[model samples]
Target: MIRLKSPSEIATMREAGRVVARTLAAVAEAARAGVSLSELDELAADLISAAGADPSFLGYRPTWASTRYPGVLCLSVNDAIVHGIPDGRVLRDGDLLSIDCGAYVEGFHADAAITVGVGDLDDRARHLSETTRLALEEGIAAVAVGGRLSDISHAVETVARGAGYGVPPNMGGHGIGTKMHEDPHLANTGRPGRGVRLREGMVLAIEPMLIESGRDRARTARDGWTVLTGDGSRAAHWEHSVAVTGDGPVILTLP
Candidate 1:
């Protein structure tokens, strides 16, 4: 069931979102070539704990996974699209890293992700990252009272397609609240005027994952949790939890 949050509840969610945003910022600032992905995870864990918020991804196990997620953040690199488990591997130059993190505070949850290029990035990598960011911005802009979910999807698809990027199929965004994942799945590509209608107090996570090559074909990695582009092309992902408000879309996950 889709639940609409009250103003007070939205305020609490914003606090949770801030914790996630701050943690991600700290991690991004600390992320550098030669730094181990596991080390970044440690930094995020400490930051979340110090803020009195719990790491939502730690110990999380999806139905298909045999083991619980062992880190506080997902460190997806290059072809690894999402759910890349943080290991002792150190980042290298020209690597595109996508870090996804979540925080649970005051009985609410907020989730966000960002993709960044390490040390010296090439032109293609830089363009992919920028495109994903803009796609997310476009998606967020479509969240408003009386708007349909497809309005957001179309906005995101228009940006990606215009940039000659491929929107990943099946994987997209979702509603977020007390639980890490909730109702109202938001697809990256869709026809406008379709799907759920937006309403005040509704919160949605608008994430756009784009592939620089081929259309949206993905494969699960050997790790069983990580997803990668089937064509082995580079991919970028950006996400933000937004709430529909009386005025417009309010990005809850902001630092």
Candidate 2:
């Protein structure tokens, strides 16, 4: 069922979103060559705890996964697309790292992700990241009173595919409130004016994941969590949790 959040619940989620934003900022600032992904995970856990929130990704076991996620952050590097587990692997210069994080506070939840270059990046890397970010912006813009969910998906697809990028078909965004994942799965590509109708109080995590080679599929990692490009292409991901209001869309996960 689609859970519509009340104003008070949205406020609580905003607080959780603040913690998530701060955590991502801190992780990005610390993301450099030689730093292990595990270190970033630890940092996220500490920051979330300091903010009086819990890491929503920790111990989360989706039915599709083989086991519970063991890290506070999903660290996808280079060709890895999403659900990348944090480990002892050290980052390197020119690597693209995608970080997905979630925070739970007072029974509400906020989830977001960002992809960044570790150091000097080539034109393709920068282009992929920037395009994915812009795609996310487009998706978020589609959220408003009386809008359709597929409109957001179509908007995201237009931006990424227009840039000659590819989007993983099965991997996209979701509704979020009191849970890390919720109803109304937002696809990366879809027909506009189809699917659920947008209404006041509906909160969603709209993310755009883009690939360099225009490949539309991904291969799961041996760890059962990380998902990488099927064609070995570099990918980028960006997301934000937003709420549809009577007037317009209110972004709750802004830093």
Candidate 3:
């Protein structure tokens, strides 16, 4: 069931979102060539704990996963898409890194992700990251009271498709509240006037995962967590937890 958050509840989520925002910022700053992905996970874990917020992704086992997620951050590199486990692999120059993190504070949860270039990134990698960010912004702008949920999806699709990129129809965003995932799955492509009606107090995580090949298929890694592009092309992901209010859509994860 879709549940609308109360004002007090939204405030609590904002606190959680800030923790996530700060953690993402710290992780991004620490991300560079020669740094192991595991080190980034450790840094995120410590930051989340120090802020009095719990790491939402740690030990999280979704219905499709064979085991619990073992890292605080989902660090996807290069062709690796979302859910990449932090390991001993060292980042290289020009590597495209996508870091996803979640935080729980006062029983509410917030989730977000960002894709960045490690060092001197190539032109294609930089363009993919920029397009994903703009797709996320376009999705957010489609969220409004009384609008259909698919409007957001359609907006995202317009941006990605126009750029000759591909967005997996299955993997997108979701409603976020007490739990990291909730109702109303937000696809990256859909009919604008279709799907659930948006209402005040509804919070959604509108993330767009884009593949450079214009093909949406991906493969699951042996770890049962990391997902990579089927054509071995690079991918980018960007997200924000937003709340629909009478005034407008408020991005809770902004620092």
Model 1 global lDDT (CA atoms, 0 to 1): 0.90
Candidate 3: tens digits of C-alpha lDDT, residues 34-62: 99999999999999999999999999998
Per-candidate local distance difference test: 0.90, 0.92, 0.94
lDDT of 2 by residue, 102-212 (tens): 999998999999999998988889989999999998898888789899999999999987998889878889999977889989898999999999989999999999989
Rank candidates, lDDT, best first.
3, 2, 1
Clashes found in each candidate (C-alpha, N, C closer than 3 A): 0, 0, 0
Evaluate candidate 2 by giving its C-alpha RMSD to the native, one decimal. Answer: 0.7
On TM-score, who's better, 1 or 2? 2
Clashing pairs in 3: none
Error of 2 at 199 (Å): 0.8
lDDT (10s digit) by residue, model 1, range 1-255: 899999998898899899999988888888899999999999999999999999989998866788898889999999888889999999998899999999988888899999998888999999999999999999988887998999999999999999898877799999989887888988899999999889998999889999989478899988888899989899998899998999999999999
In candidate 1, stretches whose alpha carbon ends up further than 4 angstroms from where it belongs are none
Model 1 lDDT, residue 241, Cα: 90
CA RMSD per model (angstroms): 1.0, 0.7, 0.7
